[model samples]
Target: MLEPSIDALQEKINSKYTLVTLSAMRARQMSETKNPLVDHPFSHKYVGMALEEILAEKLTIADGQKKDSE
Candidate 1:
């Protein structure tokens, strides 16, 4: 199965820690709200879905916060 690359996702974020934190936070949000940034179905697991969203640039981190956040 195809998977999102950690290297590529890392390039979009500041650091490895930030990427991990962002993905975890996004996965939690997705699991709690059942809302996803990406329209197409990718993965059943929230973490994988979050990673896919991050790789696609649908989700982004800004100032240590999710870009979708105000």
Candidate 2:
């Protein structure tokens, strides 16, 4: 089972599949030259950034839980 936020993220992604295509185009453009939203491959960068942000947020949440436990 997916966590609620992760599920929400997936929904956001499913709803924005068109954006994903655009992002892929942007990524390809970046690979060929440059793009402001993403400096690296757009598709990979988009997913990577989303995952990274989620991980970081989860870490913060975990730290909060630890502090509360202490």
Candidate 3:
């Protein structure tokens, strides 16, 4: 059985397949119903930043035509 924490994490990140998401997914998969895969050793330090980086790479927001000074 997987741990509650891992299950929660999987639910939190399974939808989007980004780095952070994938990390969580992997954790969930590794977890055994009620046991965390790795104690979430580095979850906080990287999850948000990793997700942001993945989104930045995938998204293509256009630059504003107007000058910042204007």
Per-candidate Cα lDDT values, in order, are 0.79, 0.39, 0.36
Per-candidate TM-scores read 0.76, 0.31, 0.24
Predicted candidate 3 versus true structure: per-residue lDDT over 1-70, tens digit per residue: 5222444443433333333445455445434344332333333433432333223332212345332233
All candidates: CA RMSD (Å): 4.9, 11.3, 13.0
Per-residue lDDT, model 2, residue 33, is 61
Candidate 1: list runs displaced more than 4 Å: 63-70
Task: Please provide, for model 2 over 10-30, each residue's C-alpha lDDT reduced to its tens digit, 9 standing for 90 to 100.
Answer: 433333453344345544555
**For candidate 2, what is the lDDT?**
0.39
- Backbone clashes for every candidate come to 0, 1, 10
Model 1 clash pairs are: none
| Candidate 3 regions with alpha-carbon error over 4 angstroms | 1-44, 58-70
Ranking by lDDT: 1, 2, 3
Question: How high a TM-score does candidate 2 get?
Answer: 0.31
Q: Give the deviation of candidate 2 from the true structure as CA RMSD.
A: 11.3
Sort by TM-score, top down from the best: 1, 2, 3
Could you tell me the lDDT of residue 51 within candidate 2? 39
Worst 10 residues of 1 by lDDT: 61-70
